[model samples]
Target: MIEALAGPQAGGVDDLTASDLLALARDRKAAEDRAAADLLVVAARWADLHPPESIHDAAAFAVPGCEHEEPIAGQGAPLVAEFCLAELGAVLGVSTTAAKKLVGHALELRHRLPRLWGQVQAGRVPAWRARSVAEVTIHTSPTLTVEAAAFVDAQVAAVAGRVGPAQLDRLVAETIKRFHLADVDPTQDPEDGYLHVDPRHATIHSDDVHYAGTMRLEAELDIADALDLDRALAHGAETLKALGSDASLGVRRSAALGDLARTQTALDLHTQGATGIRDADGLPAAREVVLHAHFDATLDGLTTVFGPTGRMEEGQRLVLLDQLRSWCGDSRTRVTIKPVIDLNADLSTPAYEVPDRIREQVILRDRTCVFPWCTRPARGCDIDHVDEYDHHADAEGRPQPGPTRTSNLAALCRFHHRLKTHTAWRYQMTEPGTFEWTSPHGHHYRRDRHGTTAVDQAEPPCPPDIPRPRRP
Candidate 1:
């Protein structure tokens, strides 16, 4: 079955019978399981090679007070060196944060959850399924002990790792109760007198996935608070209707939330005015939102009719011009249009410090970190000079080796910035908003506004009669 799906003479997938298709799927799944198991082994070995003892000399470059080993697994697991995650992420085409989680799961499985690990090795359980269990155990609130993790491994292995998230949660909760792993003391704490775990939260998931100019919101609130919010939303929706809004109840409620926020800001401003409280700019503190939108030049006249799309940098989502207009049309909303910064034109400074204008341009040009597969927003990143700036050049009266200019600057998250500065990773800006990176292992990748691409290292062979260019 595997042979039929490989190489030049492989049969077309459309020609396969239904049974053959099923067989092919099974084969692919089995291969994936094997690959996942191999990845875990490799991750464990990588952790072993870059232990805390090995990174002592590199402590100068590490974040202060973060040079210690991180115990990512349960008891008896080896502590992994913190600095080794970034290179692994680059090699795996993932972010450093993801690579760290992978290493944590690998160590948790190998050292603490032996039963599930054995099942994974024997191909009886898929690596992802086992890793899911490991993730829960390793990240338990109080941190699961070795015995508790072993108990989870045995339970999961008995079912061949076919556990659902809810089931896994139940299992973990059971283990926590049976093993007395709760972090809070019931007798000592008045709020947790009944030993009940507090699980209240309100989460606004604005990053990552957004669809149709909307973001998902989730909350687990107390019954009274939930009822109160519902009543407020209902009242706000009614108010919008009274104000001649013809939208549906759902849409009106959503708009009502926005109005509520604006109203609160207004109230705060009024209070600040009464109390003589002002911001650094000598004005009452007000709510402000910075939105970056890119629109096509051709759509300037057709915006009303065609409702052209705009890229909202805040959430990195496409917003229709109509939606943008609706946001700005609110009576309480004030729209301020700032002068546009030309991304193509280079802006420079004489000193090493990056001016606010140059920094804003860099952020706008590169919406995220320039590192391959890094999604850290550029606004929060550090502006790094592609070429090291010579601070002493002016004092010594020599030409500037590196200028503080837009062309020479790129935003990098702290981790990748540190990696580029301290490790063997190197990158150069080929053009505005485009970066070419070469990893320590000689792997090359290109990152631009369009996204990341692996650059082939092999040079095209010259014709038999043609001469190859010689290096200087």
Candidate 2:
């Protein structure tokens, strides 16, 4: 079933019909995606093909029986970049500059927006979309500070696929306007007195060479003036909403600004709601979205996403959490700790069923398929009984089930679980948050909540006489 764990004939899934594949894909995607990302990274590291070091002299570098045994260039990251550009240019038939730009875009995303890069490796975000975000964000405000630029890029990457191209551009513009304003930076020199001319947008012009509505409106208003204009427009839109108007927010706000140009209006939530133009309490609170946190994975000071979803290395997850906290606010954000599986606790009464509480604990502990090096998030995996279950009839003809307790459970994404069932490889919960696995080659592995380590001891047995399953 290594083939099922991977390969074109994976888990025999490649042979499945479209309908069957669809259902299976949902369960297998996390494992498959993580596997794919790992494989791609591995492939990139391998020198068998497309080695960047070979790019300087494509015909000579690393080639067998080549006269030039010496290297073409000194080895370092810059050389890597140069070779990448040259190689890409050759393969794609583009100039080195264009290839450099392409490589730069990829490197920027990988370096700055790790979550987005992971999604790219997971095949969730396409190349075009990632490139689009990187390019337009750069174009929108070329002078943005480093902190501002990274914040905006990461924000755009987070909400990448939820919006369209035009909307993405608009969002980029909004983010730039919010973070790249004339006074957004606080450390600017007060001695360098430069005049900031107010937005000269009393004039609106459409395509100068055509009749299209597409136009550019340049602005340089004072920060307060810009904020005031936004508020007035929002207030006007709210007032119109209170009056039962069915205009879009953009349209209503634009009209509100025009009304403000003629007659000043105010943002008064209480007044608008009293007039029945808006909800008396303003808009309803945003609904909650589940963000699985692995407290165990939260070693030191970083929190990790539960599955193959998104992640950052070292303190990056901390940065992301701070950003999310800014968005979710203090009161709305909450945390729940999933204790390590006790190997002896039963939280439910259902026969052969892992109750939600116990299942959550195992998922938090395992964080992925318990197989060695598998990074599939536990949420997308099956809760397998480390000890094989035996079903039988008890006295008086009633059904008795195998123990469905925490100590007996481990999270194994479907493929690994099936692999265990179908082959000589076997694993058992040797202790709390620990699994000892024996591979087909008799190699022993210890996978715990932390990570995998090679072991010299044989696989241990699960605690015997696990309480019989609860009565039917």
Candidate 3:
């Protein structure tokens, strides 16, 4: 019935008047409400998933304004365009083309100014008290709408103070209550840990069968004692496993063990029920833990927890369990690569160590990252082996692994650990404590350091007048 009334068929219903349109309005109103609801749902979903520009496009389709058909048809296209151009030129005091562009800008400010005026009449403020603040505050940036609104409120409060402070406070409170409430900031830890994790690329072969990969999560944790790390790991793993299963519904996972280098002690496999820990009431408490496990499906299921939950007991306990799951659920991790520089082709092992008694000897030398153009500190770098000890043959009968030695070792941070694999770049030992780096284009870079004294340079000659040559 409502559809018929809204459709062209309604023109034949002579008994129907504009008032009867409301009588058939029930179904029409319901349909309109559902349409609006559907629109809002789609708008929210689009905003959550898309960029702002895309959201604007979605909004244009979702909420179109009434068309001015009569004005365009009566005026004729060229005459209407000319009139619009002339009117815009007069308003902006510019050429018609420039005026056309400025039309939207004028309407935008003109539209918002009335809202400011309404707030003033409602005991908010007159234009005199607010325009200066509003101009600076609102026109400052398109992003600071809240700031602009705040400036309006502040200006009103100042003027109201001259009239009556109590009345002004009530007015401010009422405006906030009747209009919009500002979001409160969440309380968090003073030291927040931010991790940027890039997952290693893994391929699933045609059969969806694959064996793979490595530990590569980074965290900022206290190097010294404050929290029980092992327990935390267990709790974290539990949390992550739950998250992987249901991302939106589950808590963040907490474990940190898989990413850090481990010695593989039997303790790595141990699982114990919660026993000693307790809450303030002295009841049995849940413990934090992580245990390793494997799942054969896609690796995209992992969930990461990002913040500290220290004070909320129940939340902390749950978060800790999730963390444990994160650590234990992952069965594999990416391998860490290191770089080594070898001077001798046959020698093996890259460990560089001077005898303890000769400690003073090594320090008088090398100062920084040994790599060409790198300024990394030498103290934090690893002394890497340039070659492997074992020699293996390929199916075609070729020597596989080469030898290694101290002369092959070079200092590198974790970042540049695998950078030496580039085919175009090569480095050679010029002499002890010196290296010459050559680029693909034949460019050269030299890195050198000297000890307190040269080993081969002759010691200062003995006093010429005395027994300088007596021993010889």
**Cα lDDT of all candidates, in order?**
0.78, 0.53, 0.36
Write candidate 1's Cα lDDT for 407-454 as tens digits: 899999987887777555789999889999987557789999988888
- Models sorted by lDDT, best on top: 1, 2, 3
155-245 per-residue lDDT for model 2 (tens digits): 7667754557656655555555555454443564433222222223445442231111123445657678789878878888999899998
Give all TM-scores, in the order shown: 0.84, 0.33, 0.21
Ranking by TM-score: 1, 2, 3
Superior by TM-score: candidate 1 or candidate 2:
1
Clashing pairs in 1: none
Which prediction has more favorable TM-score, 1 or 3? 1
Off-target runs (Cα >4 Å) in candidate 3 are 1-365, 386-402, 450-472
Better of 1 and 2 by lDDT: 1
The candidate that wins on TM-score is: 1
Whole-model lDDT, model 1? 0.78
Model 3 Cα RMSD, 1 decimal: 32.3
In model 1, how large is the Cα lDDT of residue 452? Answer: 86
